[model samples]
Target: MKKIIELKQVYKDYPLAGISQTVLHDINFEVVPGEFVAIVGPSGNGKSTLLNLLTGIDHPSSGQVIVNGAALQNLSNERLSLWRGANLGIVFQFFQLLPSLNLLQNVMLPMDFLGKLSKTQRRQQAMQLLERVGLADACHRLPSQVSGGQQQRAAIARALANDPPLIVADEPTGNLDAATADDVFDLFAHLRDQGKTLVMVTHNETLAAAASRKLEIRCGRIHADTPAVAG
Candidate 1:
């Protein structure tokens, strides 16, 4: 199978008061299908910047980011948004659920945006995803009505609504307590077992070590890329 993600000589620079600040330097990365990869680094060391590039939330200053067979640098913002809705599942550190929408509605939003399924089909699939995340009973509750863990679970359900091949999470369990974080991490492991390509940016070393591979960043560069010691 083709690589699920590829980045060649990627550099990301931002203008700060008329000076270009480089956040990523000559980053060459690739992820094969079904691999669970963790990116860990110090604060402000470009971990999240790399994730943004992978998700096409931001573009690199030079070089290429090809994910799921599409060169992100070549796509316009409008096209990138559509492609992301169909090909990538993203989980944020803070659950970005629509407070006005219930859990089920939040999960259905992606399918709604993609519009490849009917209303009935979307609802059914959303419920199935909520069930998978152990949140089916709470599907009718609004995000504010749920606990932090539950909100994150609903967010995961929303992420999977489109059944995208790749899932990119930025500190998915960062805000939860130890027990709750473990629960969320378990769900990610289950998804990995089911053959989703996952790239997670995390500060939890324990969780990072459990992934199939680990990439460490330092000083705007990849410091290490090694097979993790499976926990």
Candidate 2:
């Protein structure tokens, strides 16, 4: 496995009542290609803050963040967006599909923005991804028309639009039933087997434990980092 994401002595601070409060402290972490890493912690432990840094949605106040070999601190905002669009696939908890677009259109939107493929090619690629996620027949349906699990599956396919090596999922199964969440996790596992790195922030201990690597956070610090076996 090749190292694809790294954080060095990272810290995040936010202003509260005119005083700075650190939400993440001296974080040091790395994720290599194809590993499924679950970040688990209690509420208000900065799990989401860490995810933001990883995805370049938020920058660390101090220290370095490197993803896919580029130092994030150095990229201009425009460059960062370009880099993210090209290299990282981000999945969110709410299945952030455009409500007006059909599943196939939603999946193709990323590729369309990246403009790496022709119009017809984008449609074909998105169709293939939807098919892989078991949503070929649902492609024409709006996000509102599909079941929660199917919508999540479509979101995963959209994340794969650019065929990125690293995937960051923020509470991807937080809103689903147990069986439905299991189906989503199975898809994630399959993506892992296909050599796509996954960093997931999850509160579900059962789901987190199933990941190949687990990082436990407490009080904005790493409480434990360990390997785990998941069924």
Candidate 3:
């Protein structure tokens, strides 16, 4: 498998009250093509911070974050945005869809930014994704108009809009009911089977158990990295 992401001796810090506080420490990690990885830990253990580093949304205080063989720290903000837009898809627990855009428009936003496709092509592609997520009818609806589960499905479709090679979600199932969470996770599994690399931060051990690998974080450090047991 091709290595899609790598983090070497990475550390991240923030200034709090005139003091430097480290949230992540000496984190070394990697993900290969088509792997589904789960990140788990107690609250405030820095799982989200780790995810941000992988996506280039945040930079490490030291060390390197290389995705698709490019070091993220070497890019300017403008370049990083473009690279990330084309290479990574991010999903948030809160379903961070634009309030003003309808579901179809939200899914098209990434493609719109990329501008490699014509408007008609973008629309057609977005509609297909929305339909795949069982949101065909809701494509014209605003995020507030849909149920939480529906919103999350739409978020997944939007994540795929740019057709990124990697997808990362922080607490993807955190806000949904058990059945709904399962459905969302099924989407991730399906993506993994289709050769898209996925990394998700979740508290649900049940879902974590279904991933190809699991990483347990404790006190801002990786406590364990193991292959998840298959049922």
Q: Which of the numbered candidates is closest to the native, going by highest TM-score?
A: 1
TM-score of every candidate relative to the true structure = 0.98, 0.97, 0.97
Scored against the true structure, residue 11 in model 1 reaches a CA lDDT of 97
Q: Kindly list the per-residue Cα lDDT of model 1 for residues 1-231, writing each as its tens digit.
A: 689999999999999999999999999989999999999989999999999999889999999999999999999999999999999999999999999999999999999999999999999999999999999999999999999999998989899999999999999999999999999989998888898899999998878987999999999999999999965
Clashes of 3: 0
- 1-231 per-residue lDDT for model 2 (tens digits): 668988999999999999999999999988888789999989899999999998888899999999999998888899999999999999999999999999999999989989989999999999999999999999999999999999999999999999998899999999999999999988987887887788999987777877889999999999999996665
Off by over 4 Å in 1: none
Q: Which lDDT values do the candidates have, in the order given?
A: 0.94, 0.92, 0.92
> Distance from true position, residue 74, model 2, in Å?
1.9
lDDT of 3 by residue, 1-231 (tens): 678988999999999999999999999988888889999889999999999988888899999999988899889999999998899899999999998999999999999999999999999999999999999999999999999999999999999998898899999889999999989988887887787888999998877887899999999999999999976
The CA lDDT at 17 in model 2 is: 100
* Prediction 3 TM-score vs. true: 0.97
